[model samples]
Target chain A: MRNIFIIFKRELKSYFNNPLAYVLIIIFSLLSMGLTFVIGDFLKMNDASLTSFFFFHPWIYMIFGPAIGMRLWSEEHRMGTTELLLTMPISAWQAIVGKFLAACVVLAAALLSTISIVFTVYYLGKPDGQMIVSGYIGSFLVGASSIAITCAISAFTRNQISCLLVAVAVCFVLVLAGFPRVTEFLRPNFPALADIGNSVSFWWHQSEMARGIIRLQSPVYLLSLIGFSLYLTGVIIRGKRS
Target chain B: MIDIANLTKHFGPKVAVDNLSLSVQKGQVLGFLGPNGAGKSTAMRMITGYLPPTSGSIVIGGIDMLEDPNAAKALIGYLPESAPLYQDMTVEGFLSFAAELRGLDGQRRRDAVGNALATCFLEGVRRQSIDTLSKGYRHRTCLAQAIIHDPEVLILDEPTDGLDPNQKDVVRNLIRHMGKTKAIIFSTHILEEVEACCTRAVIIDRGKVVADGTPDHLKRHAARAGSVTVRFQNAPGGLRQDLEKLKYGARLEAVETAGSTLSAVVYPKTKADASNLSAEIYELARSRNLALSELHEEPGRLDEMFRELTSQNKV
Candidate 1:
C-alpha cells in the first residue's frame, strides 16, 4: 500500500511537471465552454438542467481521455524504465492502481476546470443545482471510465500514437452506441441491443445525471468497467515483465 | 547468499539461459564474464526477479524468489544496462521517491538518501533536474537509487558501462567499499574490471560455464607451456638445431631469420622445465657470438583466456 502511494505520488507529480497537463486543461476548458454557449445562445435550448454541459461529454472524452492516458505505460516501456519498476518490490496490481489513480487525479483536475460552465448557466437562469452537480459527477465518472479503459489499452503497445488512436476508436464506439437514430437502425435486426440501447450507453447514463437523477446503477456500470479494465492492465503489465 | 540451480529461460525457440547453476556467498564479488548475447543479462534479470525462469529455483538470502518475490526482490539492488530514470525529476526528488518506494521515511530516510547521494558523488546535482544533468550524473543517480535501501545483494549489469575513466574510478571504489558487506554480482566484458574489482569470476559462453576461478588461478592456467622467441644480433648458424636437440621442446615449429635476426617457437614438452630450457638456449647462442636480442618468458594474458573461452563456445 505504501509502495502504491509512493508510485502514485510520483506519477501525479510527473503530470504537473509536464506542460501537456496545463495545455490540455486550457484547451479543454475553452472547447467545453466555447461549444456550450455557442449552441446555447444560438439554438436557445433554454432549460433548467445542464443539457449543454453534459451533452458534450461523449465527444470531449473521445480526444481528452486518450491524450491523458496514452503515455501511461507506452512511454515507460519506450524509455526502458519498465524493467526497473518491475524489478522492485511492488506487485503488478500495485503498479496498475498507482497509475490509474494518478490518471484519475488529472481527470478530476480537468473536470474541475469546467466548473465555470456551471456558473455561466446558473447566472443566466435559475438552473437546478442538483442537476448541475449530478451532471458534473456523471461527467467525471464517464471520464474516469474512458481514461481507465484507455490506460489499459496503452499497456498493449509501446507507441503512444497507437495507444491514442486505439483509445479514440474504442471510445467512439461506446459513444455511437447511445444515439437514437443508431438504436432505430438496430431495432429491426437486433431488438435486444436496441432495447439495451442508448440506455446502456454512456450518453444515456450521463443524461440521467445531468437531469439530477443520481441512480445507483449508473455508477455501478462505470465503476465495474473501470475495475475490469484496470485488472486487465495488471495482467498485461505482468506479461511484459517476463 | 544467492543460490541459482538449473536456471533456464526460453523465448519461443531460442533458449536464452540453459541450465545455469551458480551461487554467490556473502561478501563475495562474482564477475559474470561473457560475450554479447551469451545470456549474462538474461541470467541477471532472472536472479533479480525481473524475468521468471522456465525451470529453476532461485533463493536469495533464504527467501524463495518465486514464492515471496517481493521479499527476495527487496533484498537486491539491480542496475540494468541503461539507468532508467524520471528525467523530469531532480536528483533529490528522484532519490526521495526511491526511498519512499523502499518504505523509508523520516530522518533515517533522509540520512540514507544523503549517504547514497554523497557516496555516488551526486550532491552537486541534487537540485538539478535529471534532464539537464550529464550522462555521468544520470548514471550516478541510477546507482544511488539502487543502493538506497542497502540490500544484501547487488546485481549490476555493466554498472560502469557509460562512465568516463575518472567516473569509473569513483564508481569502482564505491562498489569495492560496498562489497565488504554485500554480495556483488557484476557482469562485464572488461577484463581489467575483473582484476580490479572481482574476487572470483565465472566465464559463461553459449549459455554455459567455461571457466570459473580467481584471476590468479586463470593467469597460472594460461602461464603453463608458455613460449619465448629469441633474436640474435649476429648469426648463430647451428644455434636453432642445437637448442631443438637440447630436449626442452617436443618440436620446433619454425626458425626464421631476416638481417641476422632469428625467431622460433619451441613447443615445450609437458614435463619440460623452464630453467633448463632457458639455460640450454642461452648456452647454444653464447658459444656462437649471438647477442641474444630477446629471450624472455611471456606474461599470462587473462584477456586472451576470456577471448579464447568465448570464441570456443562460439565455434
Candidate 2:
C-alpha cells in the first residue's frame, strides 16, 4: 500500500506538471457546456434541473477520459521507464492501481471544475440537490470506466494515438450497446442479444442515476468493469516484464 | 553475493545467452566484457530479475530469484543500458522517488537521496528537470537513482558508455570506490575499463564465457608471452637456424623472419625454469659477427589475446 501511494503521488504530480492536463480540462469544459446549451435546448426549457447537462456526460467522458488516460502506460513503455518501474520492489498490481488512481484524480478534477453549470441552474431556479449529487456520482463512475479501459489498451501498445483510437472505438461500442435505438432494433429479431447489451451498457445505468434513482446494481456494475479492466492491465504489464 | 548457473535465454528459436555460469563475491568488481550482441545485457537483466531465464537458477545473497524475486531484487541496484529516466522530473525529485521505491522512509530517505546526489555530482543541478539537463548530467542523474538505496549488489550495464573522457574517469573512480563493499558487475566493450577498474573479468563471446581471470593472468595468455624480436642490420644467412639450435633451443616455440628482423617466442618447457635466451641469442650473434640493431623481450598484449580468443569460429 505504501508503494502504491508513492507511485500514485509521482504519477499525479506528473499530470499537473505537463500542459496537456490544463488543455484537457478546457476541452472537456467546452464540450460539456456546449452540448447542453446548443443541442439540448437548455434555454428553451428554462428548467432548473441539469438533466440536459448530465445527459451529454457519457459521450463527453468517452472523449476526455481516453485523452487523459492514453499517456498512463504508453508514455512509460515508449520511454522505457517500464523496465525501471517493474524492476523496483513494488508489485505489478501496485503500479497499475496507482496509475489508475492517478488518472481518476485528474478525471475527478476535470469533472468537478464544471460546477459553474450547477451554479447557473441553481441561481435560475430551485434544482433538486439529490438528483445533482447522484448525477455527479454517476458521471464519476462512467469516467472511471472509460479511463480504466484506456489504461488497459495503452499497455498493449506504446503509441498514444493507437491507444486513443482503440479506446474510443471500444468505449463507443459500449455506449452504442445501450442506446434505445440499437436495443430496440435487436429486440425485434433477437430479444436475448438485446438483453445482454442492455445489461452491459454504461448508459443503461448512468441514465438511471441521472434520474436520481441510486440502485445498488449500478455502482456494482461500474466497479466490476473498472476492476476487470485494471486486472487485464496488470496482466499486460507482467507479461512485458518477462 | 550473486550466483548464476547454466543461465540461458532464448528468443523463440534463437538463443541470446547460452549455457553460462559465474559468481561474484562481496568486495569484487567483475567486468563483463564482450562485443555487441554477445548477451552481456541479457545476462545482467536475468541477474537483476528483470528477465526470467529459459533454463537456469540465480541466487542472490542466498535468495532464489526464480522462487522469490522480490527479496532478491530488493538487494540489487541496476542501471540498464541507455539509462532510461523520467525526463519531466527534477533530479532531487527523481532521486527521492527512487529512494521511496527502494523502501527508505522519513529521514533515511532524505539522507539517501542527498548522499546519491552528492556522490554523483548532481548537487548543482538537483533542482533542474532531467530533460533540461545535458547528457552528462542526465547520465549522472540515472546513476544517482540506481545507488539511492545503496544496495549490496550492483549490476550496471555499460555505466560509462557515451560519456566524455573526464566524465568517464569520474564514473570509473566512483565504481572503484564503491567496489570496496558491494558485489558489483558492470558490462562494457571497452577493454581499458577492465584493467582500470575491474578486479576480475569474464570475456564472453556469442553467449558463452570464453575466458575468466584477473587482468594480469589473461594478459599473460597472449601468444607473444616472453617473446623477443631481434632486428639485424647486417644479416647472417643461417641466423634463424642458428638461433633455433642454441642451448635453450627447446624453449623456442617458433622463429619467423620479417625483412631484416628475426623474432622468436619462447614457451617455457618446464614450469619452474623459463630460460632467458636473449643473452644466448646475443652471444651467438656476436660469435657469428652479425650486427644487432634491436633485441628486446615483449610482454603479452591483451588486445591481441582478446581478439585471438573470441574470434574462434563455431563448427
Candidate 3:
C-alpha cells in the first residue's frame, strides 16, 4: 500500500513538473467551461437542470482522458523502466494501482476546474442545485470509467496513437450504448442484447444520477468497470514484465 | 545468499535461458560474462524477480522467488542494463520514491537516499532533473535507486556500461568496496573489467555456461596446450628429434613444418610448468647449432578465455 502511494505520488507529480500538462489542463478547462456556457446554452431547451454541463463531459473526457493515460505504462515499457519498476520491492499490483490513482487524481483536478459552469448556472437561473450536484457525480463516474479503461488500453501498446485510439473506441461504445436510439433499435430485434447493453452503458445508469437520484446500482456499475479495467491492466503489466 | 536451479525462460519457440543453474555465496562478487543474446540479461532478470522463469527456481537470500516474489525481491537491489529512470524526476525525488517503495519513511527514507547518492557519487546532481544529467549521472542514479534499500544481494546488468574511463573507475571502486560485505552479481562484455573487479565469473554463450572460475583459473583453462615456437636457420629434423627427447615430465607435441619454422606445442601438464619448459627448449635449440631466432610463449589472455568459451558453445 505504501509502495502504491509512492508510485501514485510520483505519477501525479509528473503531471505538474512536465510542461505538456499545463497545456493539457488549460485546454481541458477552456473546453469544459466554453462548451458548458457557450455551446450548452446554444442547445438548451430551457431545462432547470444541469443536463447541459453533464452531457458535454463524456465527449470531452473521451479525448482528454486517453491523452492523460497514454503515457502511464506505455512510456514505462518504451523506456525499459518496466524492469526497474517490477524489480523494485513493490509488487506489480501496487505499481498499477499507484499509477491508476495518480491518473485519477490528475483527472479529478482537471474535472474540478469545470466548476465555473456550476457557479455560472447557479447565478444565471433557478436551476435545481441538487440535480446539478448529482449530475456532477454522474460526470465524475463516467470520467472514472473512461480513465480506468484508458489506463488498461494504454498497456496494450507502446505507441501513444494506438493507446488513444483503442481507449476512445472502447469508451465511445460504452458512452453510446445506453442512448435511446441504440436501445430502441435493439429492443425488439434483440431484447436480451438490448437489456445487457442498457445495463452496461454509461448514460443508462448516469441518467438516474443526473436527476438527483443516487441509485446504489450507479456506484456499483462504475466501481465494477474500474475494477475490471484495473484487473486487465494488472494482467497486461505482468505479461509485459515477463 | 543466492541459489538458482534449472532456471529457464522461453519466449515462444526461442529459449532465452536453458536450464541454467548457479549459486553465489555471501560477499562474493560474481561476474556474469556472455556474448550478446547469450541469456545473461535473461538470467539476471529472473534472479531479480523482474521476469518469471519458464521453468526452474530462484532462491535469493533464503526466499523462493516464485513462491513469494515480494520477499524475494526485497532481498535484491537490481540495476538494469539500460538503467531506466523517470526523466521528469530529480535525483532526490527519484531516490526518495525508490526508498519509499522499499518501505522506508520520513528520516529513514531521506537518509537512505542521501547514502545511496554518496555511494554513486550523485551529490552534485541531487537537485538536477534526471533528463538534464549526463549519461554517467543517469546511470549512477539508476545504480543508487537499486541500492537505496541496501539489499543483501545486488544484481547489476552492465552497471558501468556507458560511463567514461573515470566514471567507470568510480563505479568499479564502489562495487569493489560494496562486494566486501554483500553478494554482487554483474554482467559485462568488457573482460578487463571482469579481471579487475570480480572474484569469479560464469562465461555463457548461446544460453549455456561454458566456463566458470576466477580470472586466472579461466585463463589457464582456455590456454591451448602451451606452445613453443622455434625458428631455426639449419637442421630442422635434428632440432625436432632433440626437442622431442628433452621432455622431462612434460608432454610435447611437435608440429613438423609450421610456416617455414618448426612450431611445436610444449604441453606442460600444468601452466606453472610451461615457464620452466620454455627455457629448457631454448637450450636444446641452441645446443643443436640452430640459431634460435624466435622462441616465445603463446598468447594466453582473459579475452582468449572468453572467446574460447563463447565460440565453442555458439549454437
Worst 10 residues of 3 chain B by lDDT: B247-256
Q: What TM-score results for chain B in every one of the models? A: 0.86, 0.85, 0.84
Name the top lDDT candidate.
2
Task: Return the candidate ranking by lDDT, descending.
Answer: 2, 1, 3
Q: Whole-model lDDT, candidate 2?
A: 0.87
Instruction: Write down the lDDT of every candidate, Cα atoms only.
Output: 0.84, 0.87, 0.83
lDDT assessment of candidate 1: 0.84
Indicate whether candidate 1 or candidate 2 has the larger lDDT.
2
Q: What C-alpha lDDT, on a 0 to 100 scale, does residue A12 get in candidate 1?
A: 94
The stretch of ten residues in a row with the least summed lDDT in candidate 2 chain B is: B266-275
Ranked candidates, highest TM-score first: 2, 1, 3
Q: How well is candidate 3 docked (DockQ)?
A: 0.76
lDDT by residue for model 3 over B1-315, one digit each (tens)?
Answer: 999999989998999999898999877899999989999998999999888899999999888999998899988999999999998889999999888888899999889998999888899889998889999999999999988998899999998898999999999998888898999999999988898889988998877888888876887766663555556655565656666666542555656565556666666656666766788877776676666667766646788878767777345
lDDT tens string, model 2, A1-242?
Answer: 99899999999999999999988988888888899999999879988888888888888877887998999999998988888887787788899999999999998888878889999998999999999999899989999999999999999988999999999988888888887999999999999999888878877778888889899988999999999999999888877656
Model 2 ranges off by over 4 Å? B230-239, B246-297
Q: Between which residue pairs do clashes occur in model 1?
A: none
Error of 3 at A135 (Å): 1.5
Between candidates 2 and 3, name the one with more favorable TM-score. Answer: 2
DockQ of 1: 0.69
